[model samples]
Target: MVIVLKNQLRIVKKNIRQFIENITSLFSSKISDLLLAILLIPYLISKVGIENYGRYVFALSLTLFLVNIINYGFDLSAVRELAKNRHKPKMLKKLLNKVLSVKLYLTILMLVILFVVVFTIPLLRVEKTMYFFALFLIIGDLFSLRWFFMGIEKMKYIPIINVGSKLLYVFLVIIFIKQSEDYEIIILLEGIGLFIVNIFSFLYIVRKKRIRIKLISFYKVKCPVLK
Candidate 1:
């Protein structure tokens, strides 16, 4: 019985180590992202000039607003669901699919509304492409699946992937942006880089056993209205 107890204690310690590691990965990713943002902003402003840069910022804000609408509280909610139902991979897979589908529908609807608002507003209409490209940031988020990794306590090392992608974005900007006309590249980089990292995160789940994905009936889920 003492041997049994010793084995169990070791298992518990290993689990604790993994959980702490996951949390550390999350904080490290956040800090790196913050630092990257700080470093990139000045170079971007210098390249685009104040006026164009200001316009880009405005466009990002609008896109961010729409992104939040699509995400809503799914991060917390899905994490809760996973935490409760974890251990049952089959069930967790269904819930993940349902949540992703619901998010996709919301994203499409929100995009439609965003376009309508952008086109209808005479002032915003001029920068419609910029606003629309920024939408890719959110679209890329579809693949992030952060809640999945968080719930699983795997974290999947976002800091490494995110920082790598951001560095590429920085490189692209430095090489391409010599004038105001190149300002559009900024949005493009955001879109492309976000997708790259998010795709990396998603594949980490799908390819490895880090997490599982399965098809499930949407009707089984009582998804909130943009469902």
Candidate 2:
């Protein structure tokens, strides 16, 4: 009975440790996101002038709508799937591949749609470059594997890479953005940071985590969408 109790206590301690780590990492990432908004957004508004800033925000809103269409609730569903299959290497790889493949297809379709809409709308046509630049945000999100890490309950890397990338973005903005004209590059700067960090994180997951991404057939990819 004493030995059994000791084993149970050990399990409890391990679970508690994991819970604390997850909470701490989540908190750190959220704080960094908040800081990015609080610290950089006002600076951007000031440097870019209200008119240009308003245009950027308007373009951003449009991009976000496409982002949602591409996302299609995979962020939540994939996390649940990953949690279930994390220990099963074959299943996990297949599932991950399906999700990635589907998301890639969706992104491409959205990009084309965005191109059409931006060109069709006379108002959006004026700052079409900004709209196209904002498309990179979708691409950046495409490569982000925060859902995978969260599924495995290893949240540490999310905050580290997130904070690093945001810091890089802030630094680049401060150095390059001198006047309202520079507002055009603001989204592009963010895209650069996201690409650098997310690509690194994706490679890290592949090499360090030993998870490989393979392309599957449309038939295999079709079921995930229905589910």
Candidate 3:
């Protein structure tokens, strides 16, 4: 009986330690992101010139707005749902599929809207290429299943994967952007980095957690299953 009690205590301590580590990882990731942004922004503005940098920022802002719409508060709501139903593997898997499918549909709709908005406006139409590159950001965000890690309460991978991806973007900009003409590469690099890292994260989750992701049909996704 005493041995059983000792084992339980050890398990509790391990869980607490892991929880603290995950929290620290999250904090560090945020700090790294800020630092990277600070380091990259001035360099980009100097290399690409203010006007081009402004264009990239403008395109990014529009893409970000659409990205958030597609996200649809799933980061909060889906995480809560997953946490509540985590013990039931079958239900959790179904919920994950539904959430992803719904987001996919939203993303397609937003893409169509973005295309129309970008082309109809003269200012946006003039810089359509830059806007085209910015579309990568939305694609990256769509594949980034950060909520899954948060829901499962195994957040150690989040910092590593995200920071690495952002660092890659910074590296690419520094290496490739030598003049004002290279400005378009900035957003393109960022999008590429984001997409690669999130893909890796998704694969890691599937392999390590043994979670299969079979997206549900649109009909099922549109059902009131996910609120």
Return the TM-score for each candidate structure.
Answer: 0.86, 0.93, 0.89
lDDT: worst 10-residue window of model 3: 218-227
User: Which stretches of model 3 miss by more than 4 angstroms?
Assistant: 1-18, 223-227
Model 1 gets an lDDT of 0.77
Per-residue lDDT of model 2, residues 1-227, tens digit only: 99999999999999999999999999999998997899888899899999998887887787778878887777688888888888988777777677788888888889999999989999989888887788778898788888788888889988998998899889989999999998778888887788789888888877876778787666767666526
Clashing residue pairs, candidate 3? Answer: none
What is each predicted model's overall lDDT from 0 to 1?
Answer: 0.77, 0.84, 0.84
Candidate 1: RMSD to truth:
2.9
Count of steric clashes across candidates, in order: 0, 0, 0
Model 3, CA-based lDDT? 0.84
The digit string of per-residue lDDT tens for model 3 on 1-227 reads: 99999999999999899889888989988998899889889999999899999988888888988998888678788888888987888877787778878888888888899889989999899888877887788888877878887887878778888898998898888789999988876788999999999888777766776778887788767765466
- The 10-residue segment of model 1 with minimum total lDDT is 218-227
lDDT of 1 by residue, 1-227 (tens): 99999999999999999988987898888898899889988888887898999888887887778888877787787788787877887766676777777777777788888889989999999887777677778788777777776777667566777777788778778887898877766787787877888887778666764445554445644446223
**Residues forming the 10-long window of minimal summed lDDT in candidate 2:** 217-226
